[model samples]
Target: MDIVQTQDLRKRYGKVDRVCDLSLHVPEKKVYGFLGPNGAGKTTTLKMILGLIHPSDGGVTLFGQPMDGKNRLSLLRDVGSLIESPSYYGHLTGLENMVVAARMRGLGMAEIDEALGAVRLSEAKDRRVREYSLGMKQRLGLAIAILGRPKLLILDEPTNGLDPAGIQEIRELIISLPIRYGMTVLISSHLLSEIDQMADVVGVINEGQLIFEDKLSALHALSQQALAIRTTDNHAAGELLTAAKVAWQRSEDYLLLNRLRDDNVARLSQILVAKGIGLLRIEERQSSLEDIFLRITGGAVSL
Candidate 1:
């Protein structure tokens, strides 16, 4: 079942269109990635879903009910969100902060401890939030988010301040949250690799519009051939590629190609050998999510 649904959902800030005719369907107990560059309206769309802001046009529904009016509060009772940044009183200890939050929602001490343990911050639960590192603070924030045992988890850049280990820990925690607890997750980030690794489904937005939306596996299957070629003579290899009419680009070590008209290895070897350019290596593999992003976004280097 789709726990979250948006049909032509739109939001505007005066003359600027923050989200443009966007539509999305997120399955229950699934990890969905909302990806885009800065100012791409990803956060705006999320806010609309949470009913923190009103939509200018179209509609948003959560848990099969329209998100607005009196029902919004009850709808959000099962939902948790951390938009942009997680805020906590600097003077309050981590555990104290969570305690305050839990009390507001009538949660118990057991729930607070569980949340702390899940983020692996149980040892430092007594430390003042102001003294914690950026990574630790991020984890604490996440702990607060899950304190309610929420069915829907919406995290915006949850891994922003985490270290390598912290990031991996959060990644594993997110993947497990849905499976182990039956929670539905919707996370937004500009990092494609992070989303590629964690998400079961992906929706990419740009300039206030969704460019692509599909299952993670289905989107990766859209492209096939991954070409790898390296040569001793970079300049000569360029000339040889020009003559063969093969589409290729020079990476750090290899010339990456896609959709070639002929056997790139055989044709490249022959041409390079004829031109006295040594063919180092040629390998073919499956395309990655990064390759798909570049292909679809016209090498839209994230700003």
Candidate 2:
């Protein structure tokens, strides 16, 4: 079942379109990555879905009901969201802040503790918000979002400000939410690596247009593969590859072999062996999400 659906959803300011005619479907119990460069209307589209803003031309449906101004409370009750940056009081302790939110949402301390534990911020539960790091603040915001235990969670840039370990922690947490708690997630982020790994499906937006929407692997598989081979004898490797009829290019001390194949590698290795070329390392690589984004958007959007 589709947890969210948008048909011709559009938003504009004067004559400039912030979000063009966009349409997408997010299945229930799945993580959908909403991707685009900076100012790709990702956040704008998300706002419309959340009923925080009005749509200029089209509208959206959440949990099978038409999303509109009148149904805001009913729709919002089942949804929990964190857009842009989560705001907190500098003087308030983490637990106090969460308790305030819990009371407003009519929840209890048990719910607050669960949210804190979900983000692994239980140890810092008593720390003041002013003392929290950027990553800790982000996680605190996440704790509040999960406090309601809503059916759907909409998070924008969910992994921002996290360390390597913290990033991985949030990644696993997001992936496990649906399976462990029956929650549906819609996350928007500029980090393609995180999205590629976390999202079950993805929607690419650029210049306020929904350019592509598909499964992460499906979109990635549409591009060509490249191989990065590291060897000491770059000159000799290039010569051997050419003599073996394998196409390649040089990048510093590495050789980039386009359309690299298993058979091609075997043949090239044999040629290198005959030429006495020293072997160091060999690995196949595909065009990364950033590569695909550049190819599709003409490298207009900044990272």
Candidate 3:
């Protein structure tokens, strides 16, 4: 089932287009990575879906129903979101903060403890939020977001300030949401590595437009693989490659070729050996999620 679907979704501010003709499909019981460079309108699109901001044109269907002013509140009852940054009062204790959120959502107090436990914040529940470390605060934010166990979870940069261990904990927690509680998740992060590991599907947005949306594996497969070859005689190898008219680039230590198929590798190896250019190592290198993302976004590096 598609938990959230947007058709030609557009958002504009005066003369600028924040999101243009973006169609997003978020499946049920899976994590959908909403990827984009900074100021690429990811947050804007999310806000439109949550009805926090109105779209200039197009429509949004969430939970199998149109997301309009009339039904937004009812629809949001089954959704939990932490956008941009989590907001909490500095003076409030962690447990107190959860209590206030639960009360607003009409959730049971028991859920507060469960939420805190899920984020590994139960031990620090009594600490004032102001005293909590950045990572701890991030976890507390997550705890509050999951308080009601909403069917849908939308988290934007949820691990923004976490340490390595905290990142792994949150990653594991997110990956388990579907199997453990059947929750559909839509997450946006600047860290492509995190998205690569956590998301089943991804949507790449740039310049207020979606450039690609598909399974993570499919996106990876779309990138061209390079064959990295290290030879004892680098000059001879380059000369041979140039003579053969094969497309290659010479790095300081190795020759990088675009032809990476098994046949191509075998043929290249034979040619190099026959020419007495001893091959030390040859390996096929697939592009990382970051590489693919930069390529799709016209080399716009993520902040």
Give one digit per residue, the lDDT tens place, for model 2 in 177-239. 999779999999877788888999999889888888888888878777878787668887887
In model 1, the clashing pairs are none
All candidates' TM-scores?
0.84, 0.81, 0.89
All candidates: CA RMSD in angstroms? 3.8, 4.3, 2.5
Q: Point out where model 3 deviates above 4 Å.
A: 229-255, 260-282
RMSD of 1: 3.8
Collision count of model 1 = 0
Top lDDT model? 3
The segments of candidate 2 whose C-alpha lies over 4 angstroms from its true place after superposition are 226-286, 301-303
Q: How does residue 264 of candidate 3 score in lDDT?
A: 74
Q: Which candidate comes out best when scored by TM-score?
A: 3
After best superposition, candidate 3 residue 229: deviation in angstroms?
4.2
Model 2 local distance difference test score: 0.86
Candidate-wise lDDT, in order: 0.87, 0.86, 0.89
Model 2 TM-score, 2 decimals: 0.81
Could you give the candidate ranking by lDDT, starting with the highest?
A: 3, 1, 2
lDDT by residue (tens digit), candidate 3, 1-303: 899999999998899899999999999999999988888898999899999999999999988999888999999999988998888988999999999999998888789988998888989989899999988888888888887789999999888878898899889999988898889999998778888889999998888899999999999888777888999998888988999898789877989988567877888889889888899998887877677777778898483
